[model samples]
Target: MKRESKLEFRLTYDDSKEIEAIVCIIPGGAEDMNSYIYIDDYLTRNYKVAVININYHCIGNRPHLGSSFYLDDIDKFILDTSLKAINLKCINVYDINSYENLNNTFIKIDQEIQKLKLNQQLHQNYKLKTHVSFLPFKNEYQN
Candidate 1:
């Protein structure tokens, strides 16, 4: 059975300045976005980064055929669409420690955040260079 899916997310950022980067928190197993509040809070409160808590496909075990959560093509589509929303040339950090594990790591989120925070200088001045093969892509593909 196929179910309609939408990119559900919670974007949290401190409006003190232009957002430096975006942190994506993806929960695993039957956990919902709420389960990663600690990570979200730590990112936004401590750093000048915007945190996007993504409720990826099959979260909370709504419905599925397999015994466990499998990364489907649709899941990639949803994740791609979600990240594409931000046009800024900022660093994107994906926290997938709890992506597909039934018994995922919790403390890893904190550790990872700390690591990224410490390495901010490495990417702080980085800029993305875009080369256009043809004209800019049409916006009609957006739903």
Candidate 2:
């Protein structure tokens, strides 16, 4: 039998200025085999946003397939942090489970956020004073 892995993550963000939104990244399966990968600090610095990636592991490679704690825990975090959105409404939660998918989603979300406002560059990366852009992406293939 395989042993469960420990939980860990790296959170990078700007607290000086209120960013547009907060991104919640919850990795499924093993903590070592992460499901997301942040490219650079461009999004956080330029956009003034917060990024949180929580990682945990079970006894199997596909722990998410048999457990609900990952989603459930992240959901609770969403609800708790939802109030942090001072400018906009609430936070944006991207339920991603793959590195490639996370990269694509980050770019798309960053591009979209930049397009949403006319003034893209505001004090480096400060875009909107609203809130974090919470985009929950569901894998259509999942049943």
Candidate 3:
């Protein structure tokens, strides 16, 4: 019997930002192999996005697959490559088992990214204000 594989994925991002990150989880089998193409195409047209592919072995008593040994390294490589390709800091990834719980996780990650972007904007604004405030003091001391 051909082994059956199931995969679940969630795409999330900071709604306020034009750039978005996506995480995908693939459990067992070679489902990731196929899904990635679709994702790549989808993101190419929209906001810049990166995808992390998590590969896991879910079959009973099966030996670890050759690809599993370097899962982390591969994930990092893909993420970096995607970052360059999309020119966006967002990244998304998933593990096979987490597919079932993706809904909640997706929402949580989206909120976190939004918060981070907001904080970064605020920091930039504060720095601008501080620089402007210091300009007059520097000029007075120079004279």
Candidate 4:
């Protein structure tokens, strides 16, 4: 039996407050420890950075089947991590699979942020009110 190990991950932040995180999933082997080391150094140099990793098992060697099936899981991980980074006030979140559909995701996120900002501004500037108005009914009863 092969040994189980942690995956390697790296996180870096720039002066502009953008956070970049990456996880290297080595196929058919355990996690790479250097990923964590690099992430640690990055975090030390830059504030508000997060890095994490997941292990992928070789086919016929572990409980899980293969890496292809884990694509959804990986995507969710990236989104969740990105959201967390955003909550931490990071300008951006970079991922390994960011090249895939990232532009669309970023656009959607930007729209939501804009909507929130607009709502906040409206709330601060205007008061909300509810009113009911009804027109007179025809003279059917009189007829």
RMSD of each: 21.5, 20.9, 25.5, 25.2
| Candidate 2 positional error at 28, Å | 6.1
lDDT of 4 by residue, 22-94 (tens): 4333333433334356655556466644444333322222223212212234454555565564342333333
lDDT of 2 by residue, 13-71 (tens): 87786967877766643433244554325567778688777654332334343322123
Instruction: State TM-scores per candidate.
Output: 0.39, 0.29, 0.22, 0.21
* Number of colliding residue pairs in model 3: 9
- As a whole number from 0 to 100, the lDDT of residue 131 in candidate 4 is 24
Which candidate order results from sorting by TM-score in descending order? 1, 2, 3, 4
Candidate 3 has its poorest 10 consecutive residues by lDDT at: 128-137
Task: Tell me the deviation in Å of residue 93 in model 4.
Answer: 11
C-alpha RMSD of candidate 4: 25.2
Candidate with more favorable, higher lDDT: 3 or 4: 4
Model 4: ten consecutive residues of lowest lDDT: 134-143
Find the candidate with the highest TM-score and give its number. 1
TM-score of predicted model 1? Answer: 0.39
Alpha-carbon deviation at 40 in model 2, angstroms = 5.9
Show pairs that collide, candidate 1: none
lDDT of each: 0.51, 0.46, 0.39, 0.40
User: Model 2, poorest ten-residue lDDT window?
Assistant: 134-143
Winner by TM-score between candidate 4 and candidate 2: 2
- Clash counts for all predictions: 0, 9, 9, 0
